[model samples]
Target: MADPTPAEVQSYIEAGLPCQSLSVEGDGRHFFATIVSAEFEGLTRIKRHQRVYAALGERMREQIHALSMKTLTPAEHGATQ
Candidate 1:
């Protein structure tokens, strides 16, 4: 299978998770994402990543090679901006 594009990965996440804001940047094998969502509000960092992984599902293992992400709640994201 071909590696997913950043747009494809972004769509995959959006399909499964509700996001206030999300952006992904990557080459074929590696990706970095900044994801903002209400669902991450009370979750730990690890759990937040887990939520994104769950959204990716089998695609995470079969297509994408690596993903490094910044996961944040809407409030947290707002604070950073």
Candidate 2:
């Protein structure tokens, strides 16, 4: 299978998860994503990452080689602004 582009990965995440803001960058192998969602509220760092992994679903195993992510709630995202 061909490596998914950053946009395809981003779209997959968007389709599977509800994100207030999401951005992804990759080199066709490794990917980094900054994801903001209300769903992340009150979750631990590991849980937040788990949520993202769940969003990626089968792609995580079959296509994406690695995904490093910054998961945040909308409030946390706003704090950065």
Candidate 3:
């Protein structure tokens, strides 16, 4: 079977985060995900990312080779955009 694509991972995470925008890229092995979520508010970077990783569950350790993430709260994203 083929490995899950970055978009697939992104969709999974997005489903879990909800009310967020996500950008994802991968070489079918390593992946980078930028997730913006209201749920990230007041959370530290590590905690925000941990939430994303938790959404991935065991796939993060088993199928996913690498995941680099940038998590931002809605306000934080709005300021930059």
Candidate 4:
């Protein structure tokens, strides 16, 4: 009945991707997350995003309606402006 704040989403994502930088936006129902993690190094973009979704667990289906994610490796993030 209440919107999950951006900080809340950021916290969840951070827990999933330690040592990473994250930017998350959510309307409590839909969320957009941008994450940079070294853990994503060898993983495909789909797999990397799946990992973040997994971190959200049932919330993804039950509470969260949609998640638009952009996951990048640390190096990739650093390369970007």
Give stretches of model 3 more than 4 Å off: none
Q: What is the C-alpha lDDT of each candidate?
A: 0.95, 0.94, 0.85, 0.81
In the order shown, the candidates' Cα RMSDs to the true structure are 0.5, 0.6, 1.1, 1.4
Candidate 4, residues 20-77, lDDT tens digits: the string is 6889887877788888888899999889988898888877776677789899998999
Q: Model 3 Cα displacement at 5 (Å)? A: 0.8
Q: For residues 1-81, what per-residue lDDT tens digits would candidate 1 score against the true structure?
A: 888999999999999999999999999789999999999988999999999999999998899999999999999988998
Please say which candidate is ahead in lDDT: 1 or 3: 1
Q: Give the lDDT of residue 79 in candidate 4.
A: 91
Question: What is the model-wide C-alpha lDDT for candidate 2?
Answer: 0.94
Model 1, which residues run further than 4 Å from truth?
none
Full candidate order by lDDT, most accurate first: 1, 2, 3, 4
How far does residue 44 in candidate 3 sit from its true spot (Å)?
A: 0.4
* RMSD versus native structure for model 2: 0.6
Measured against the true structure, the TM-scores of the candidates, in listed sequence, are 0.97, 0.97, 0.91, 0.87
- Tens-digit per-residue lDDT, 1-81, candidate 3: 478898888887977787468999999879998888889888999998889888889888788888998888888889899
Task: Provide the lowest-lDDT 10-residue window in model 1.
Answer: 1-10
TM-score quality measure for candidate 2 = 0.97
Give the candidate order by descending TM-score: 1, 2, 3, 4
